[model samples]
Structure formats: structure tokens, C-alpha cells
Target: MRKHVRKLKDELVKRGLDAFLAIQNTRYLAGTTAAKAVIVPTDGPPVLICSRLEFDQAKREGWIRDVRAFSRWRAPLRPGERVSFCEPLQLIADCLRELGTRAVGYDRGGKKFVRKLRAAHAASYRELPELMLELRKIKSKEEVTLLQRAAKIAMNGMRCAAESVTVGRTELEVAAEAEREMRIAGSEGTPFPTIVASGRNSWLPHASATRKHLRRGELVVIDFGATWGGYASDMTRTFALSPTKKQLTLIGLVKRAQKAAIGRVRNGAKASNVDKAARIIISRVGYAKFSPHGTGHGVGMEVHEPPGLAPDSKDILRERMVITVEPGIYVPRVGGARWEDMVLVTKKGCKSLTA
Candidate 1:
């Protein structure tokens, strides 16, 4: 069994759960996102339940040995597996009944799943609060390697952006160029839509790329992320066309703020402290109003996960936790500048994965 599964099983025992159902976070436990649901019994081997179409793929990629399928297209059955055609919900309930589990735990994503399972099974279903988050927050050595590869791909995309962005080029054109480069560099896919905002559009933090032509002396914010092997990396870089003094200053301040936030990412540091470290730097220069978003967020299977670097966040930093330290300044009618990078939290400090 994978270490992730062992950790979950240990937690299941502590919570007095006979079995734990996973609809989401299947990728975290078993390196495959193909499984629709996974059941981890406290005393027996875990089982992966996927659609018949995905059965072969999940069996090939999953770490666990027991993989079952539902919603028929009739794949070859394993030894002693007689039932070949069962509805997904009935199969799930049957599996729990076979395990003789009375109390089952499930993630937040299993609300509807549990409701349906309750109608079919007599097992008690309860939510496991932050169970997957706690299990996936820490990066194993292999997970870090995958994240590093993702970061390298994202960096290649940014380099493409630098070469492609020029006066008169449409924002969409630049974004397309960067995305193509990332694909060529071996990214599984983009974690989120690429953000290539120029001029007034850059003033919006989550601005979508448009057909607007890039103008001289306008700031361009390119936020992009690349995924590899179910891991993700996020990064942002600001470019100036003709280079105004204000644009340069904004870039410099945001960069410094990002650095400050990253410096506070060591183990045991509070997530709010990291956000404050960046906020204070930008606020000192009277750009506090211009900075609306949080300092950053955790980057993993999903681009935005846990351990958020925001003022109201209660998460604490821990070693091997991968996160992004992003700081930005957006002035209305002027433009916006953001600096973001993925970092790995360590005991002494954090290492930049997307420098």
C-alpha cells in the first residue's frame, strides 16, 4: 500500500471509522484520477471503484490491487467477482455491506454520494473534516519531484510570454503562445486558464485574456500554471511595454512583497503571518488599497488547495507543504503588477520551485 493510504487508514482508526469513502482525492491516494470512488476498509485492503469505461485505466494506474467497475460495458471480471451489472450506487452499498462496515467516513465532496449511499445501505455516513486536506497537504519526495517538473514547465511558458508579448500583439495571442510552449514542454495540461491581461484589463486581478491589442507603456500581467502527473505549479510575471517609472515601481514593490511573504513560509509559521509580511510591505508604500487579493495559496493536485496565505486563514505552515507566495498591486486606470512563485516549505526556510 502507498504511504498515503496508510496515513488515511491510521486516521480512520482514530476516528472510529470502519471504512472511508473517497470520491475526490482519489488521485492523491492512488496516483490515478480515473477512479470515481475508492473505499478504504480499516482492516482490509482498499478498493477502487470506477466506471466500466475507466476500469482498465484505473487498474493500470492505481496503487491498490482491488479495483471494481460499475455502469456496464462488461469488462473482464476478476476471480470470484460474479456481479457484472450493478448500478454505481448499489455497487457502493454492496461493497460496504460486504465489508460489514457500520460507520463510514467520507470527504466533503461526497455529500450527494453519501445521500444516495444512505438510501441503499444501512451504514452510518459521516463527513471526515479536512481528512484529504490533512493527508495531501504534506509533499512526499515523489510528489515534490512531480511539482518541480510542473514548475519548470510553467517557467518555460513564462519565457514564451516574454518573447511573444510585444506592442500590437493581442492578449489572446500572447496567451496562446505561452500555452503552446507549456504543452510542448510536457505539461499534462493547464491547471487553470492562462491570464494575459494588458493595460486597463490588467487592473482586474482575475482578468481574462481578450483580443485587445497591447499598447506601449502599459503593464501586462501574465498569470499561468502548468500541471504534470496530477500536480500543479502557479506563477505570474508583469511586463512593461515602453517602461513607465510607475509601472517599474509597481513591479519592484510587488516583487519585494512576494519575497517577504516567501521568507515567512518556513515550518511552524502562521499562514496569516505570511500574508501580513507582504501586505505590510505594499501598505508602507500606500498601495494597500491597490492590493485586494490574498498573498498566495497552496499549490498541489489543484492550483488552489489549502494553507491559504490570507489575513483570515487559520492554517499554519509545515515542512514539505508546497505553496505559492504571490503579491500584487493594482491601481485603477493605471495597470496591475503581480509576482507569484511556488515554494516548498522547509524547516529553516522555503525553496522556490517556480523561480
Candidate 2:
């Protein structure tokens, strides 16, 4: 927690701002209207202004420094009062003004308060969503631990998915099995909808699980992830319900490509280089056109983060950074094959944390 605050402070200094205003409403977390208001000031502890009703809950979470109540009718106004509806934002802005903050940074999508602040005070406001993105790009030790836990839950789900691969089993059945395993393994929920595509359906990247039954000698693509403690772990593994010569061959190619991509990951390597390393092998196997998506992406609080491994991405790999190395090939009428693994960038090479 202190580390996150320090990082936010450093960002404020870098951006020449005195503080940051983080405004979040419903859809931010569990769809609650008592939006969270956080004021991260440079050179001191951060303050979290939450609805009076949520103050106790936030304090219990211990994710922030100071937790203050924003009320409408008591001294500050009570709950169910119209005045309380307007107190949080005004208090936040007033606090900034008192700190002599002339410029404040924020993430995007708070136009209402931005307009109000601009109208009331002469303070210049800047939006730096990217700053928050960059700060979150590198995971801390606690974050890495949580991600490891998430990965374990995902691996459990993967094991369940692998076991569910069999002739006549519907795609939805396989997906449901994976989801049940994730929940039993302590995952809050699946990070995204589980993808259980068999045979032709495997060719679709984000194919929704359906009732189509699996067939012998067909490939089943299981793309899934689980969320634990707000961190996400993504992985994909293709299975052959009944082995066929051609299916095994394509899976081998994709596995090789994924291995090559993971082998190329290291500190200071260009994201594009890792992607190219995988694409080259897949292309050499006469499947260039079949490979659609980028190799992988950074995994963290969000399923997908910065430093995407793509041909056009300029992100440089850094030590301690965790990312996915997934390479896939889809043959239109045949089937698709992909192998994904979460890896941690290291000084010499990379380690597959989810392996």
C-alpha cells in the first residue's frame, strides 16, 4: 500500500502536478452509486473519500491511507439527504485548493466533476489515465503473490478443462466444468467468459461456449482465466479429444511457436521481438494467414494491460514483469490450435509461472 502511494507520488512529480483525483462510480466495482473519491497528493499520505455508508467497509479493506466519510445531513449532512450528494466532490476540490494545488491530474471519464472543478476554481486539470496504466504495469511483490494465487486457480480450471475433453461432451459442459473448478479453487469468478470451442468452432478466437458436442479426432480450444483477489490469470491449452495425425501435427506447430515466444522473453527485449519470434515459426509452418491475434499481453489487476506483444507494439520487456505468451493458428474448416502460458520476465530469461 505504501509502495503504491509512493508510485503515485512519483508520477505526480513527473507530471508536474500536486495531486491526483480518482473519481469512480458504479461499474467501477460492483455497481455501487456511492462513487469512490481518492485524493493522492504529492509528498504525503493519500486520502480516500467514500460515502458514509462505505467508509467502514473501505477501512476494513485497509487498501488506502485515510478514509473519510462524505455525508449529507449530519454535521456534514446525513444519508438520504440531497446535500450529501454534493459534498464529496466539493470537499475534494477544496482540499486540493487548500494544499495550493494549481494543477491536478485525473483519469478519464469524470467530465461532470471536471467541469464543476474548472468552473469553481482556477486550478488546471489534466487527465493521465496512461499514468495509472504505466504505474500498474509493473507488479509489486504483493501483487505478484496475488497473481500467483490467481494462476493456481486458473491452472486448476485448466486441469478441469483438460479432463472434460472427450467425444460427445458439449462445449458448454466443458466450460461449465472449468468454471466450477475455478470457483471451488477459491476464484472470485472467471476473468472472462470461458471459451470452449471444438473442431470448427476452435477457429473463432472468442467463440462462446455452445451445445455442440465434441467429436473424435477433433481439437478443443480451452481459453480461460480466473480472478482471485482482483488479479487475473489467463491461459489457453488445446486438447485432442481423440488423437488424429493431422490434429497432433498442428498442435505441435502451435506449441513450438508458443515455446519460441516464451524462450525469447527477457528484460530489455522489445515486445515486438517476442511476437515476431513466435510469428516467424508459425509463418514458416505455412500458417501465417491463420495466425490472427498478437502473441499475448501483460496480465495484472486487469486481464489485459500494457506492453502488448504485437508486431507494432514498442513496449520493452522489463524484469519482474509478467505477461502471457500465446500463439495460435486457425485453419478455417479444420480446427484451431493455441498454447498459452503466463511468464515472468527475468534478467536472463523467463519463467513460466503458470506452468
Candidate 3:
């Protein structure tokens, strides 16, 4: 993440901003969700500000060295004794003012906070959401390593869930078993709720687990991901309670769609073209209407990010960008099937992490 911070600083300099201020809750700063803040200057080490509640832990786990305890609110005014409450982000404003920061960039901040910054220090601010997103779109080597581990855990969960599918087991039970395996296997948590949909339920693309029991000759779709070290891996697999011609055909078609799309994922590939690759197969199978969503999305700290793989997307794939190649066809009574895999873009081609 040192390189990420350094690149951000470069962008700040190019924008004529003195620094970049990122709050913890935004989840764009260092892939952290802790209740803290980070201020990165163009020419110096970044500073981390932690509230009293998060101070000790931040000091232990934070990357920045200049960690400071966030200042507390002043004692309540003594019956109108001519004292004023602390301004919004007073500590942050004071730090910037002392550093002579006349301009700053941020991913997101409230109006009140921006107003206080301008009023207290005469500092101007510009939005850095695009810059942040661009930085996050390409996965660092370390981030990809973490995501590779996450993908392994998710693959194991899928195996467990597939084995648990039987005539008597409810969808909820299968999902629970998969979730348990992920947790037991060292996953910090799940990116999203485990999904185990069977029979008619499979027709609903994002269906959650229900008490409905599985039965023979039905389709079952399990979609889930594991979170490790704040990175996520997403995948989906379809199973059959009992083999049938139609269900098997549906699964084959989805596989073909995924293969066609994943083959197009490489550095310099147009994201929309990848979507078209998948859509061509589904449309050829006469199930295009059943596919409602995009083919895939960039994945990392968040389950979904930029560089969308869809018909309307203008994003282009870049080397080291990890994404999900998910293709599905959902039909009502005929049942539905979807297969997804986590892949990493490469200069020559892409590697399937779930393979």
C-alpha cells in the first residue's frame, strides 16, 4: 500500500492539491473500514488520526507512522461562559492549517466538514473519487495474493455446499454448512450472505437461502464468497439433485458462455466486448432474455468495483486487475443455471483463480 499512497500523492500534486484526506468509513483509504482518518501529503509521510476508541489498535495495525489520537470534544460550555464547541474535524483542520495546506483532495466528505475546512483554514478541496477508483481498479501484487487465498477458501466452501445438496436438506442448511466451512478455514468473514437456491428458486438470480427443501431432478445454484485479510473472492456453481437432460443442457450452455467471456479478459481488452462474447453464446442458445444482469465486475476489497463487463461499459481491462466472470440464464419453469469464476487479468491472457 506504500505505492498506492505514493501514487495518490502524485495525483494530488498533478491536481495542485497539497494533500489528500481520506476518512475511514469511506473504505477507499488503505482498504480500511476502521473509524479513523488518513492525511497524505505530496511530499511527506502520511498521518493517521484515530479516535480514542480506536487509537491503540490503529497504532498497532495502521501503516502510517505519524499516528495521532483524535482530539475529543471540549467540555460542555459552562453556562454560556463564552466558550465554543470544537469545529467539525477541528484537529484535522488545525493540522492542515499548520502545514500551510491551501488545497486538498478527498474521496468523500460531508458538506459540514468541507464548510468547516474552508472556513477554518481557507483550504480549497476537490473530489478525488475518480482517482481513488482508478487506483483500486488495478490490483496490487499483495492485494492479488490476498485475493488468491480468499478464492481458495471460497472454492472449498463451494465444494462443501455441493456435497451437502440432497433431497431432504433444505437450501438454508446447505448454505449454513458452506458458511461454516469458510469460517473454520480461516476466512475473516463472508463478503455477502451465502446463497443456496434450488428448484424454482434458482430462477431468481440473487435468491437467498430459504427453508424450501431440495428434491430430486432439480437445479441448485450456490453463490458465495470468502473474505480474507479484507479481500474478497466471488464464485457461483450450479448442481443437480438428480441428473436430467434439460438441466444438464442449461449448465453446459452457461459454461460455454462463461468460457467465451473469460477468454476475452486480457490487458487492453474492452470490457463491453467481453460481455458481448458471453451474450453471443446465451443468445445463440435462445436464452438471452433470461440473462438480466452484466457478465462480470471488478473485485477486490469490495465485492463490486469499477471496469464493469457489460454491454454499455466503456472501461478497459488492465493487467493485474482481478474480476469475476459470471454468466447465467434464468428461466421460470425450465429452471436456470449460472457458473462464475474469479479471474486475474494478465498481459497475455487471464488466470482463473477458482480453477
Candidate 4:
């Protein structure tokens, strides 16, 4: 936690800001997702703000010692003010006012938030663009451990999904089975909604599970993730009860494409090149247009994050970054197959964590 604060302070120093305000889900910094806001000043300890409802929980779970709770009912007015402010933004503005902050950096907010903040306080605000992304992309040793555990848990779910898949079963049932297995395997919860797209539904990469039953000789794309200690890992596998020649070919190509993409995941590797490695493989077989999404994405606290592997991406792969290599080919009215695996970027190459 101190290391994260120091990094934020360094960023603040570099940007010439008095403080950085974190209003979004900053579990990566505060060690608790319940924190409503974290005021990271250039000096001294950072302050964590929580709602009166979650104050005790945040105080117990958060690493920041200076935890405060605010409520309109509990606020005391000093002047001829008729009533206390109800919005939590007002409370945060009051904190900045109390700190005498001249300039503040914020992680996320829209025009309304900015206007309200400027109206409430005297400080100038600047959005710290992608600062959190820069910090969250690199996984520490402990973070790697958590992600590895998550990968194992996700693999358990994947194995369950593969085994439970059969004709006459509903996609929702298969999803439930996989989710149950992951929960039993010590996953806190799923990182995202468990996907069990069978038959034609598999044509859509991000299709949701439905009551549609699995049919023989049809492809079922199961994409899911597991969360462990706030870290996440994602994986996808296509299954078929009775495979056809086309299905086998599609699976083989997607698996090879995923392997090629993973092979490109190393320190100093271009994210676009990694995407191209998979794209070119699928393109050779005239399935390029069938694959629309990016090859892969970073997986960490959230299911999808920075360092996207796409043709237009400008991200560079760095060591210790955990990302997914998902290469898929979806054919309209036919079927689709995706093979995804979580990989840990290394100096020389990358190691598959979901294998």
C-alpha cells in the first residue's frame, strides 16, 4: 500500500499537482474496494473516505489509516447555512478545502463532477490520464501469485464446463455447473458473467448464456474467469460432443492462433504484433473477417484492462504483465471456436498460467 502511495506521489511530483483524488474503484491502491474516495496528497499519509454506511467496513479492510466517513445528517454547519450538503462530492470537496489544496489530480470523473467540484472548492482539477492503468498493468510477485491461483481456479471451471457439456443440456445449466465448480475451488466469485454459448450462439464471441440446449456436433464456446483476492484470470474453450470436420478445423486453427499469439508475448514485444501473429494465422484460412474482436487483453483486478492486443493498439508488452491470448474464428450460421489462456509476460518469453 505504501509502495502504491509512493508511486502516486511520484506521479504527482512529476505532474506538479498538490494531490491526487481517486473516486472510482481503486481497490488496487487502497486494498479495499469499499473505499469511496482516496485523497493522496503530495506529503503525509493518504486519507480514505467512505460513506457512513460502509465506513466501518472500509476502516477495517482498507490499508489507509486516515479513514473518514461522511453523511449529510451528521455534518455540522458552521455559518448561516440552512442545511448540510447531501452529496458525497460535497464532502470530498470539503476535504480538499480543508487540505488547502491548490491543484488536484483525479482518476475518473465527467463534466458534471468537474463542474460541481469546481463550484464547491477553490482548487483546479486535472484528469490523470491512464495513470491507474500504468500502475495496474505491472503485476508484483504477490499479485502474480494471486493471478496464478485465479488461473488455476478458472481452469477448474473450464474443466468442469468441458466435462459437463453434452447434448440436451441447457447453456444456462452448463454455466451454472462451471460456476459451481469455480466457487467450490475457492474462487471468491466470477470475474465476469459466465458465458456458455452453444451452437449458433457461439458465433457471437461475447454471447450470453441462455435456455438454448446444446446439440450434437455443434460447437459450444465457454468463456469465463475466476477471481482470487481481487485478482482475476480469464480463459475460453470450445467444446463439441460430436465434432464435425469443419469444427475440428476451426478449433485447430484457433488453438494454433492462440499459441502463436502467446509466443509473441514477451518483454519489449509490440501488442499489435502479438495480435497480428494470431490474425495472420486465421487470415491464411480466410477466417479473418469472422474474427472481429482484439486478439487478447490484460486481465487483472478487472476481467479486461489495458495493453490491448489489436492491430491499432499502441501498447507494449512488459515483463510481469498478466494478459490473455484469445484467438477465435466465428463463422455465421456455421460455428465458432475460441481458445484462450492466461499468460504471464517474462523477459525472454511468456509462460502459460492457465495450461
lDDT of each: 0.89, 0.81, 0.84, 0.87
- Which of 1 and 3 is ahead in TM-score? 1
Model 3, range 275-315, lDDT digits (tens) per residue?
Answer: 99999999987888999999999998889888789999999
**Order by lDDT, highest first:** 1, 4, 3, 2
Per-residue lDDT tens digits for candidate 1, residues 1-355, read 2888889999999989899988777888777877777898999888888877777788778887887878655666666443448787788888998999999998855567668888888878888769888878888898899999999999999999999889999999999999999999888888998999999999999998999999998999999989999889899999999978888999999999988888788999999999999999999999999999999888889999897889999999999999999899999878899999999999999999987
Please provide the root mean square deviation of candidate 1 (C-alpha atoms, Å). Answer: 2.0
Better of 2 and 4 by lDDT: 4
| Model 1 TM-score on a 0 to 1 scale | 0.95
TM-score of 4: 0.95
**Among all candidates shown, the one with the greatest TM-score:** 1
The candidate scoring highest on lDDT is: 1
Q: How many steric overlaps are in each model, in order?
A: 0, 7, 0, 0
Q: How good is model 2 by TM-score?
A: 0.91
Q: Of the pair 1 and 4, which is ahead by TM-score?
A: 1
